[model samples]
Target: MDELRRALQTRIEAGTLPGAVAAVASSDGRARVDALGVTEFGGEVPMRRGTPFRITSMTKPMVAAVAMMLVEDGTLTLDAPVESWLPELAGRRVLRRLDAALADTVPAQRPILVEDLLTFRLGHGLLLGPESDYPVAAAGRALDLTLAEPFPRTPYAPDEWLRRFASLPLMYQPGARWAYSTGTLLLGVLLSRASGVPLDDLLRDRLFTPLGMTSTGFTLTPSTAAQLPAHYQAGERQDLSPPSLWTQRPPFPDGSAGLASTVDDVLAFGRFLLSAGADLLTPSSVQAMTTNHLTGPQIESAGILLDGSGWGYGMSVTVRPDDISGPGRYGWDGGYGTSWCNDPATGRVCVLLTQVSDIFWNGTMPEFLHLALRCNVPA
Candidate 1:
């Protein structure tokens, strides 16, 4: 564990990373937390355990957890269609081809299911097609239908954003393929409409509160806001610059990317996931969530995102043992630099938070995962 701490410190001293906060915990609640580097590149504030990280797409798991809670409570069902809640998605269309024109579409065979949203297979995504005429791609970008893929988040209020999203045709039939980001955002709306409450409030009552994760939320309270560091976007030369205004709350709390939390907050949730949802979620639901639900071309569609793992509801469930961890080790990374892993096999939980984007693919994440894995679980 000391080696892990020193290695992270070495990165900070080398100026490769601005700041990081990491923690490793076991079943009994004992934890080892290490903080390294300044809050901003050359700023005076030191990184602390309480530092609120932007935690981007990592928001999916907690938001997914909220949806599952409703599922368990009988307010929502996994395989059931979400059309009842948000009428915008009731009668959907699918493109005949990936590059097909919007008008050249077919009627959806079935409504998008709750399971489809949970599994990220509900047919819409940030396709980023270079052909600017692609209506779905054009509409997504013009309406700001995403958050923090490349940063400077989507600016639309949730209702208008949903309206714009509803106007776009599905990239594929419901449950046909796995797409990035959009299904999760839509799931946020699904949870809100089905629960008849805001997503944040549902998350607060069902997840954040029970987990004792005080610093985790879509909106930053002043106290937690103060702990937030200047977020940086990594340049080609490794120069870290503050990307955009992240200090204030956004108009819509994007379930896929809009979240701010601490290492402890992440770890607490990680531990719950390891504990198969602890008291908040059913073990069966957790089991289903951590199980690999994507198959066939879906894996191919995911490209390298799965990285030889499987997609559980909100996080990546390890399907096969890798160098750092084994099958059943589940969790995901944030678009802004933060990642967590829960190894049910070894009873280990690791939470690592930083301020760079796409930290999962970079050597930095795997390097830290190795170190954290090396730590003997706290007695």
Candidate 2:
């Protein structure tokens, strides 16, 4: 455990990151949890074990778990069209080409399915490379859809957000290609509408409460806001300071990237999935959610983000082992410099939390992940 702490401390001292909290648990009962460095560079607040991080896209897996629960409760079905609950998306248009104008479109080959949302096959999402700045992505930005930015969140309520989203044409036809970001956002609203509960309340009643994840939610009250570290990009502080963006619930509870959580809370989520939902979700549902749903071509289309991995429901599935992990390990990263993964082969769950977004693109995140695995896993 000290090895893990030391590794993070080394990075902190090296100016790679401000601070981090990490936790690991294995099925045979071996476990380690530790925190190192300060909340931010040169700050007096020591990073505590329970400090909350803006888990960002890590919110997807939790939301995906709740969606599976809804599937089990008969509130939703995977194969069914989502138009029943999301009538705003009943009629949809798709761009003819990745660079096509917003009005250069065709009717959707089919309605977006519940499975599409979970699997990220719902067409419109973040584009990469040359197509990234295409008209559709521009339209999404103009509408304040908050498609991919982790900070500076959407201001519209769910209904208005959905209305704006539905007004645009999908980049690809539903179920045609695996895109990123948007589907999970759609699932957030779909989950709320289908259950007739607000997204925040639904997540609380169904997932967080059941898992005893006390430190996970859409917003942190003022009293607990101190637990949130100063978020950063590069070395400068971001605007997401304490008692601000995360203190009060945003008009939109972004299912894709809008939750603050502690490392243990995320670790518990990994454990829940590793336990095959442990009574909250059926084994089959867990299987479906963790299994790769992308075709090879679709994976290729996903480009750098997939990075030769596969996407299951809301998380990335490791189809091929790499330096940091083995095949069948399933987890997701939060754009805000947090990583969570569960390796069923070793029955190990690992979580690393930090507030610097640059670490993901920089080498720090991968180094931390590799070190965490090496420190804990027996030879």
Find the candidate with the highest lDDT and give its number. 2
Candidate 1 per-residue C-alpha lDDT over 214-300 given as tens digits, one digit per residue, 9 for 90 to 100: 888777766657667766555332222232344466677788988888988898888887777788888998888888898966876
The lDDT for every candidate, in the order shown, is 0.79, 0.86
With a 3 Å backbone cut-off (N, CA, C), the pairs that clash in candidate 2 are: none
TM-score computed on alpha carbons, candidate 1: 0.93
RMSD of 1: 2.5
Q: Count of backbone clashes for each model? A: 0, 0
The worst-scoring run of ten residues by lDDT in candidate 1 lies at 235-244
Best by TM-score: 2
Models 1 onward score TM values of 0.93, 0.96
Clashing pairs in 1: none
